[model samples]
Target: MDISMGDEPRRLTSCWLYWIAVPTGDQAGVMATLGLTQPTPVTFAEAETIIDEDGHGEAEGNPDGLSRVYVSPEVDGWTLVIGWWCDPCDGERDDEVLRRVTELSARYGRAQAYYYGAQGDGSAWLIAERGAVLRRYCATGEAEDDLFTLGEPLPLERARRNELGLSSSWGKAVGNDEGGSEWKSAAFHLAPKIAAALGISPLALTAETRVRGTGVLALTPQGAEAEPVT
Candidate 1:
């Protein structure tokens, strides 16, 4: 059965979520590259349920609290790996997450990860190419500096800034008039658009989306080698 995209493109969920999109339909290769194992076939809806229900739950296999990702096959030449543990905004794990995403890009040529938290109204995105991260941005909708930023602003980001009458250059003062939670909130909404522009956005998946093969549930590396309890 095919799932409808509906009007869910802008909202990840009621809380938080993270997903990685790569430009390839090689499901097996993607799982292997991510060090994921124990694949279980599942429908797109079931996959979403698994991720949503177990995203923050502790499981026997995941003793380290790593993410158990749902690996979608090919959706318009891109595969999405959904799991909360893949979050890029985690301060402590941000570096490791970026490293893994960069490595994934190295193998696949291009990869992107997105994070959104409804509670804080935070959104983040990272785009990597050939093992190097080209751009990364985060906004928490708080009265603080940008959480994290790197490389140059993406064309969409530049255009957005221009539309909002903000500075095109990063770190450049855009005056208090143009600086407020509006821009940060805008970032939250922009994450999905960026995903749509670059590849497939999880929220954009629908019956109309080109899907090849089925999704699979896989254990993260932390749980891949765990021994079953006696």
Candidate 2:
């Protein structure tokens, strides 16, 4: 009798994630501007509990200190997940989703931002600011070579790749190290650039940044008030 391992667990596929640099005290305004509803406040410990209990994939938190965690019911096949400390999950890359994320980032004075998503036969990631797509990647095939970049490379884009232990062939083709280093480095280096472009200090992008916000606010259309997600 062959006892086989059960079906492989689904990898936590990232949809789209963003890093917004909200001001220390203006989270409410930013949320409202994004049409998000008032959020439920959860302490770092409580946030961890929620992630362990309800999160679908690998959930990460801002190590510095998670002031609050926000969660909204699934909307249009996607959910709005926000953390005041900086780290948040990716979501669907719909136009509305992108528009909201871009709006929030800009409202918060061009906060550091990133978005990623995978649907059907394609996957893409974006580093954006003030409603502009700064750098992006779209996967064509399973191979790293299948991935394509959009927008011009940043001045330090190549150097960032090197720092992340990635090779120049990254995204062009699968290298000996595979796409692991390249993918990881993309965000690591890109974060600093996002902060810099927004005129925010690099240190602000780290977990040490002490930003705060109302957690898990709801987003509604203009001329309407956002309701808190229960």
Candidate with top lDDT is: 1
lDDT of each: 0.72, 0.39
Candidate 1 residue-wise lDDT, 34-107, digit = tens: 78888877766566656556555544554334647778877888888888667776677788779888988999
Cα-based lDDT at residue 116, candidate 2 = 29
Worst 10 residues of 2 by lDDT: 1-10
Clashing pairs in 1: none
User: Which 10-residue span in candidate 1 carries the lowest summed lDDT?
Assistant: 5-14
Q: List per-candidate RMSD values in Å.
A: 4.5, 13.2
Candidate 2: residue 186 Cα off by (Å): 7.6
List the candidates' TM-scores in order: 0.82, 0.46
Tell me the tens digit of each residue's lDDT in model 2 across 9-106: 11121232333444324555655655545355543334434433222333332221232234422212222344322332222323444465567656
What is the total number of backbone clashes in candidate 1?
Answer: 0
**Model 2: residues with Cα > 4 Å off, grouped in runs:** 1-24, 57-92, 115-125, 138-149, 163-230
